[model samples]
Target: MKLFVKDLTVIDSSVLDYSRGIIGQSWLVDIVLHGDLNEQSMILDFGIVKKLIKSTVDELVDHKLIVPAHAKFCDVMSDGAFTYVDAWREHGESIHLACPDQAFALIPTEQITLASLETYLTEQLMLRLPNNVKQLDVKLREEKIDGAEYCYSHGLRKHLGNCQRIAHGHRSTIEILRNDERDSALELSWAERWKDIYLAEHCDMVSGSELSLSRAGMAALTPEHYCFKYQAPQGEFQLAIGKSIVEIMPTETTVENIAQYIADTLAKDCSDALTVFAYEGVGKGAIASA
Candidate 1:
């Protein structure tokens, strides 16, 4: 008997590359188990599978940063309650992250990849399954679109729930309406600005800090770095990264704030009312107008 669960949603919080310092990826998960029918005359109850799988995945990774421990450019330290990371880019630029233990997953892989993650997840799920279960298969996928979309990662320390973890993100599509007409150019511009970017609140940024390298240095290869620290419901979270890759908002980095910012910005350009649909991920988000 084969049992499967499709479209298990998860948010991947991790830093995959130096250029894209921190990425919160929206993952569509699929799981399959091969096993014998139990006394209940079923491979496994769908309800049980859904509950267990969702909880396991959520508890393990959902909003936490997934760091590749063996990566040459990555160095990690942990003191039970907190984890610190320093990652250097190919050209000597770097990103530093410090957060509560619950905010990160230190993986054994040399690099963080879907395949490596799947392997790790499989090992975990296998141990939790019934003895009759023989094969466990897991698939992780990102939503793809032909039109304009942006990949971004962020952490919301103020959130009381899982979002309080220092990293998690989305691949989202935005829609802008100018006088009730779709504006592709405006949508594209927003997408381009947030592409592979990190969104942070202005209040979280350190004040009056000049952390960037000197202009006479390799300006193009080395981006100016900025540091931010804040306390949330979970614990203290700190992040340092290239200033050029960050999109700072006056308000919190929630979808509601994003939409409001867009609407207000567009309103300044014209007298017509503007509506902004800012998606945090697929199928849901906030809509605001000005």
Candidate 2:
């Protein structure tokens, strides 16, 4: 017998990549189980499957930075309180970060992929399932929509909950309206700006001039790279990368703030009439207008 669940849950995460730096993504999950009928004449209880599988997925992957331990140009280390990660791009662009150990997952692989993640989840589920279960399957997928969606990463140091994790991120879709008419062009532009990008808090930025190396390197690098650090409820966190790849906001990076920032910024360049729909994940989000 086979039992299945569709649209099980959505996980927002970040993957460290040598070529793309840290890429944020959103994945929707589906699950299937093969087993003989249990005492209840069911392969598995739907309620139990929902509760058990959802909890497992959330505990392991949700709101975390997922990195591959064996990826080249990647180095990870840990002390008592924090996990330190160093990742370099193909061209030598790099990021050095430190956060609470609970903030990220160090998978035993060379890269992060749907197939690998599915395998890991299947293994975990197999261990937890009843003896009657003979096989488990996992399907990890991302939404397919042109320009409407994006994969991005961010940190919210001041947050009291899991958002305090510095490397966690989301895959979101954006919508924009100009003078109350849907503006696909404007929406696409904003999506492009944040695609695979990191959003940073302006107050947390460390001035390049303050660092001798950054100060010296600034002259040779266009747009320049900035390093930023902060302390959150989890622990200390750090992020260093090119300025062009980040959107440094004067306020927090919540969807509420993001919507307002987009509306306010576009109001200055185009017109005072604007509405921004900023989604943190699937289904619901925040809206702002000017």
Best by lDDT: 2
Residue-wise C-alpha lDDT for candidate 2, range 164-275, written one tens digit per residue:
7877888889989988898998888888878888888888887544432222233433335677778787767766676656778899888899889989988889954898
lDDT of 2: 0.81
lDDT of 2 at 203: 87
Model 1 earns a TM-score of: 0.90
Error of model 2, residue 8, in angstroms: 0.9
- Candidate 2: residue 119 Cα off by (Å): 1.1
Candidate 1 — which residues are off by over 4 angstroms?
207-223
Worst 10 residues of 2 by lDDT: 211-220
Residues 7-48, candidate 1, lDDT per residue (tens digit)? 966655655565566766777899999989889988778888
Off by over 4 Å in 2: 207-224
